[model samples]
Target: FTRQGQSCTAASRIYVHASLIDAFVAALREAISKLKIGDPLDEATDIGTVISQRQKAKIESYIDLGARTAGAKVDRCGELPGAAHLKDGLFLQPTIITGVPEDSPLMREEIFGPVVCVQPWDDEDDVIARANDSDFGLAATVWTNDLRSALRTVQRLDAGYVQVNQNLTIQPNLSYGGFRKSGLGKEASLEAMLEHFTKKKTVVIDMR
Candidate 1:
């Protein structure tokens, strides 16, 4: 998980098609297994500690919540740093969870840590609806090769920023922000300058 999944726009709720869910999870597990968990200063380390112990606990609570869910499966990879290496630092193993219900808090809340929830989708409309059901709609990604399907899904998604077959990449020239509870205004670009950073006023003298 990049930046320990701490970014606001992290791809947390991954909705894969029913046909690909199995293979997707398997590949994800394999990829996660190779991640090196250790000191942040170490070049060999792929993942480091979260910001603090409180954040570590918050993420662990979500993991526990997923485990307690009836059908949800919690998956983790790599080993925790040994005490000799850890030295009281806060770190969490990257986690990948599947079969969590849509209504569960794990799916609903913004868990700003190294945890992700994978769910399967069948119908296009249903998947789109499910994706938009959340209060947070900052960013979304559609990973389909079909142009038609990608365009269709992209246009319908409620996120302020949508990516096609790419990870979240915020560029300086592009307007960046979110919808609903994600945020109110934008950052970067001209739109943000006019709408968020600047105020507009009009005055008329008695020309008549």
Candidate 2:
């Protein structure tokens, strides 16, 4: 980490390790490639259009911004842009970007699209260090066949929630929140029971 990336890298956020990073990214890339980018009405399509036209435009703008940044690369299905003609139904292909700079806008901003950004680290400690550096402690998952690493990471990560050996979203029973900008507070049955309510009182008395 240099002066440029050092700040963002340590800005209280989560980051993945270099060793495990590539494999996880590879798995996601493979899955994204398999996604069918087409109209929902078309049974062959695996994914539908953006929730709103605004979101479609947002993705476009994000891509544009990414292109200008350092080593940014975006790849999407050739059919996605053509699908725009389906005005009644919007659709975009799965987009993947590599070589994105650590401090680039693409990495700093939340990309809630098929688009994914990849950055690498050295080891488990590095990954945990990067993750904890971020202000956002929303959620993180560690995927590995190794039970020891999974258990250790879950205990050490700064995020409110950590799912071991499972690369997925927050479950209903699990609490969810970020340590910083990622969230204001956590919400979950367990968390609620832990600190959702409280009571206190003071009684004054005189003694000689």
How far in Å is the alpha carbon of 184 misplaced in model 1?
Answer: 2.0
Give lDDT tens digits, candidate 1, residues 1-208. 7889999889999999999999999999999988988899899898998998888889999999999999889998888888585878888899999998889999899999989999999999999999999999899999988999999989999998999989856888799999999887898798886898778899989988
- The alpha-carbon deviation from the true structure for residue 123 of candidate 1, after best TM-score superposition, in angstroms, is 0.5
* Model 1: residue 73 alpha-carbon error in angstroms: 0.6
Local accuracy by lDDT, each model:
0.90, 0.60
Worst 10-residue lDDT window for candidate 1 reads 80-89
lDDT of 1: 0.90
C-alpha-based local distance difference test score of model 2: 0.60
Write the residue-wise lDDT of candidate 2 on 1-208 in tens digits: 1111112122212245666666866676676666665666677766677667787678778777867766666666334535446656656666666667666666666655556566677776766775576545666777678888778878998877667765455458766556777656566567554654433468998996
Q: Provide the clash count, candidate 2.
A: 9
User: What is candidate 2's TM-score against the reference?
Assistant: 0.71
Query: What are the TM-scores, per candidate, against the unseen true structure?
Result: 0.95, 0.71
